[model samples]
Target: MKAIHLKTLTTIAAAMVLSASFPSYAAEDMSKMDMKTPMPDASAVTEGMVKKIDKDAGKITIKHGPISNLQMPGMTMVFHAADPAMLDQVKEGDKVKFHVEKMNGALTITNIEATTK
Candidate 1:
């Protein structure tokens, strides 16, 4: 009985020491904890031409180059706008740089800018 009690205490102390060596993110502010996907860098932006825009549907169709962040090949596809006003920033046939990510099970354009080329 004495040996069993000593071993249990030693195991508890070891666990406590191991746990202290790691930082705890759970104690941080929940609001600051962004569980969403990380924002892509400027280099991750894909060049594309706007093929269509439907403000009412809040969607944009783009014929874009390979998206490195997504590991997606160059293709034309419809994407949801993170903000409906994003659709107003470009018209059909405009050349643009954009960032896209999967959000809520849908492909969404998080950032977009019109380009002269």
Candidate 2:
């Protein structure tokens, strides 16, 4: 009985020491954390030309260079706008920089801006 109690106490002490060595995050306030996804920077934006804009369909067609983010080759394709208002910012034949992501089973343009070039 004495040996069993001694072994149990030793096991409990070892467990307590092991747990104390690791920092606990439970005490930290999660509400103060920035949980939103960070926006892609300018370097992540792909250069493209507006091939078409269909406001009624809430889509835009772009001829874009290789999109490294999507592992896509340079090609012309239609994309749904994450926000329909994004279509209002560009017209056909305009050079633009944009970012795309797969959302709701569709390729959606998350960001876009017309370029002087």
Candidate 3:
């Protein structure tokens, strides 16, 4: 009967140790929690108004919505054009839908289209 009591104690001790270890891991995870907004997906697109166009610099400034791919908030920022010919297709005050991505370590508009509304 003493051996049975010892076995029960050993089982309880092992379970206690295993469960105790998990709480520490959980607590550690809690301590390193992320308290920021969810990140945007990589293939997201944004709508923007063309603010400026600089063909000579191969850049265009747009007041755009959140660029999910870049995690950037809506603001006026200059983005390098992937193709300079794109400049001819857009002008200031135009509403456009554009896809932005990191290219050569710069924010670049990979594809853009002028919206009719």
Candidate 4:
């Protein structure tokens, strides 16, 4: 009877140890953690004035015209560009029509050409 009791205890201990050693795959769904949302590739076009420029930081501030994101009913306000290179052909008080696109995690101007207006 003593041997039987020891065997039962040993079996229970082994079972517990084995269960604890491995991850609990049966309890929860692992697929949800790996899932990610697909974001759209959207670009913005604006006609604005260059308010500030920082060449080192790759950023430019623009007093944009009629920014829809701010619910702005056509007002002049400052915005930061994802790339400082956008200011290469532009400077303060220069009138330009810039095309900004979302890349990586920031809004950058992919195409910036000079305008006569």
Candidate 5:
């Protein structure tokens, strides 16, 4: 009976040692942290005005004043859209609130619908 008690204590001590060593080697997963915070998903967007539209080049030159993600050191300039078809409903001097996305190095307008009051 004394030998059995010694073995049980040894097993308990081994288990405690293993439990203490496990968390030290573990790392926290950062994938859950949202670094690319998304903006409000709404069609009610009413901002920016169109500066230029070129049908021949299939692109539009938007003088985007300031965008949330477009935060940079220099002033705003013209941006190119992959699909000029997005400009079908938009016209020069028309106020719009469009959202752009970068896909494979090209900045494209993913959403450019009209905005209501």
Candidate 6:
């Protein structure tokens, strides 16, 4: 039927337009997304031991002390690093002091340093 054909054409056109516009839409969506939890203060850095490090993924697993700013009690959890290059300074079993924040809806390490003392 002509009505069915017209509906199919409309759906296909809409899909094409959406696909073509998706990248911009996604970028805008990211900017508009709300973080449910407040970010931890940068000044309230925490000390932790690196349990794992995935350089390729820019993530690290740490067993940390209490993060008072975020109201997070110490536990081991994985976090994305703000700068992948900082991953180079750390390895598993190393002690580190790091800055954490709620970045793009997840807890992220914004600053990090490896330490022995």
Candidate 3's TM-score: 0.61
Output the better candidate (1/5) by lDDT.
1
**TM-score to true structure, per model:** 0.65, 0.65, 0.61, 0.46, 0.50, 0.62
lDDT of each: 0.89, 0.87, 0.83, 0.60, 0.62, 0.85
lDDT of 3 by residue, 1-117 (tens): 335688899999999999988755477777798743232343687999999999999999999989877788999999998888888888888998888889889998877778953
Q: Give residue 111's error in model 2 in angstroms.
A: 0.5
Candidate achieving higher lDDT, 4 or 6: 6
Backbone clashes, each candidate: 0, 0, 0, 1, 0, 0
Full candidate order by TM-score, most accurate first: 1, 2, 6, 3, 5, 4
Residue-level lDDT of model 5, residues 1-117, one tens digit each, is 345688899999999999998764323555555543343464322256677888777676666645555443223456566566777878887777777666787665666655532
Tens digit per residue, CA lDDT, model 2, 15-97: 99999998666546666676534458866779999998999999999999988888899999999998898888799999998
Candidate 4 residue runs with Cα over 4 Å from true position = 1-44, 67-84
The reply for model 2, stretches above 4 Å from the true place, is 1-39
The residue-level lDDT of candidate 3 at 97 comes to 85
Lowest lDDT sum, 10 consecutive residues, model 2, at 30-39
Please identify which of the two predictions, 3 or 5, would achieve the higher lDDT against the true structure: 3
Q: What is the lDDT of residue 33 in candidate 1?
A: 82
Those runs of model 1 whose alpha carbons end farther than 4 Å from true positions after fitting are 1-40
Question: Between prediction 3 and prediction 4, which has the larger lDDT?
Answer: 3
Q: What tens-digit string does per-residue lDDT give for candidate 1 at 53-84?
A: 99999999999999988899999999999988
- Candidate 2: global Cα-lDDT? 0.87
| Cα error of candidate 6 at position 21, Å | 31
RMSD of each: 7.6, 9.5, 16.0, 15.0, 14.8, 9.3
- Which predicted model would earn the best lDDT? 1
Residue 80, model 2: lDDT of: 97
Which of 1 and 2 is the better model by lDDT?
1
Clashing pairs in 3: none
